[model samples]
Target chain A: QKEVEQDPGPLSVPEGAIVSLNCTYSNSAFQYFMWYRQYSRKGPELLMYTYSSGNKEDGRFTAQVDKSSKYISLFIRDSQPSDSATYLCAMSGVGTNAGKSTFGDGTTLTVKP
Target chain B: DVKVTQSSRYLVKRTGEKVFLECVQDMDHENMFWYRQDPGLGLRLIYFSYDVKMKEKGDIPEGYSVSREKKERFSLILESASTNQTSMYLCASSYGGYEQFFGPGTRLTVL
Candidate 1:
């Protein structure tokens, strides 16, 4: 099984809708979970990062990790058209390995007007 | 602000040709990484350097090499470019944390 698994979603939603993106992993050793936003033909920009199992909020985005179930999620509140992009889930082990991450296939989100 | 810059935004090369992708970060980050992004495959690390003159192979390092002569610069070399090597190449740098700043990717197409 892949170390990280995320649905390749071209999820379409109206503006102001709440968006929830999720990813699951098979490696319990992964301690750092991150979410990245990538526009078409562009490199990924880090959105939120959480260590172990907990929640971190940054403005309109929230990241959660559940080590017990190896699940991670990114929640976007009051989604806007500018939020239309690919969301990538990433994780890494502790210490040195924390700099090197295993990334998911990414989910595409399009917020419409 | 942290800034990462790539040598090219797009490149086209012939099979068997040697190709070089360059990256530079102004943050003086301790870690620099090279990754290729492909549809469905996501981002796969090719190589990384923690300091100048030091390099480490990543998950997919075959047919590829890296050079880190300076702390701010990292280069990925394709010994012989192949069709399969045509993908979006991304460079990132971090100061020992999960927050990695990325450059605008270089889309390489090997014919």
Candidate 2:
């Protein structure tokens, strides 16, 4: 099985709606989880980052991690048209392995007006 | 602000030709990485460097190599490029954490 799994969603939603993107991993050694946003033809940029399990909120984005279930999620509040982009979930283990991150296929989101 | 710049935005190369994709980060980050992004494959790491002249192979390193002659610059080299090497190449840099700043990405097409 793949170390990490995420649905490649071309999910469409209206503006001002709440969006939830999620990913699951098979590796229990993963300790750090991250979310990245990528626009078309551009590189992925860090959106949210969390270490271990719990929740982290920044601006309109919230990242949650549950190590027990090896599941991670990113929620976008008050989604806007500008928020339309591909969201990628990435995770890594501790120590030297921290530099090595495994990424999901990414979920594409489109927030329309 | 952290800035990562790639040498090219788009490139078209012939098969069997050597290809060089360069990346430079102004943040002087301790770690730099090279990854290829495909339609369904997501982002797969090709290589990474922790310090100057220090390099490590990532998940997908075959048919690719890397160089870190300076602290700010990391390069990805494709020896005898093939059609399979056609993909968007992304460069990222970080300071020993999960936060990595990515470059604009180079879309390479091997014909």
Candidate 3:
């Protein structure tokens, strides 16, 4: 099995709808969780970052991590067309492997007006 | 704001040609990484350097090598480009390894 698993959904939603993107991992050592947004033909930019199992909120986005189930999620409130992008979840462990991150297959999202 | 700049936005080369993808960062980050992004495979790490003159192989390092001669620059080299090597290459840098800033990416096609 892949270390990280995410549904590569070309999920379409209307503007102002709430969107949730999630990822699951089998590794238990992951302590740092991150969400990245990638536009077409562009590199991914960091959207949200959280340490350990908790929730972090930034503007209209919220990132949640559940270590017990090895699951992480990014929720978008009042989604806009500008929010249309591919969302990737990345995680890394502490110590020796801290510098390297394992990424999940991204979920593509399109918020239409 | 941290800026990561790649040498190319698009490149096409015939098979067996040597390819070089350059990445430069202005943040003076200690960690730099090279990753390839494909349709299904999100981003696979090719190589990474924690410091100048030091490099480490990532999950997919075969047929590729990396050079980090300066603190702000890292290069990924394909000894003999293969069709399988055609993909979107991305470069990233981080100060403490938690949050990363990425470049625009280089789309390379090996025929």
Q: What lDDT does the true structure give each of the candidates?
A: 0.92, 0.93, 0.93
DockQ metric for all predictions? 0.78, 0.75, 0.74
| Interface RMSD score of each model | 1.0, 1.1, 1.2
Candidate 1 Cα errors over 4 Å, as ranges = none
Q: What share of the true interface contacts does each candidate keep?
A: 0.77, 0.73, 0.68
Error of 3 at B22 (Å): 0.6
* Preferred candidate (lDDT higher): 2 or 3: 3
| Residue range B1-111, candidate 2, lDDT tens digits | 999999999999999999999999998799999999998888988999999999999888999989999999999999999999999999999988778889999999999
Clashing pairs in 3: none
Candidate 2 RMSD to the real structure: 1.2
lDDT (Cα, tens digit) per residue for candidate 1, span A1-113: 88899987889999999999999999988888999999988889988889899999999999999998889999999999999999999988878767778899999999999
Off by over 4 Å in 3: none
Q: Which residue pairs show backbone clashes in model 1?
A: none
Instruction: Assess the local accuracy of residue A26 in candidate 2 as a C-alpha lDDT between 0 and 100.
Output: 95
Evaluated at residue B60, the lDDT of candidate 2 is: 89
Judge candidate 1 at residue B103 and give its lDDT. 98
DockQ ranking of the models: 1, 2, 3
Error of 1 at B37 (Å): 0.5
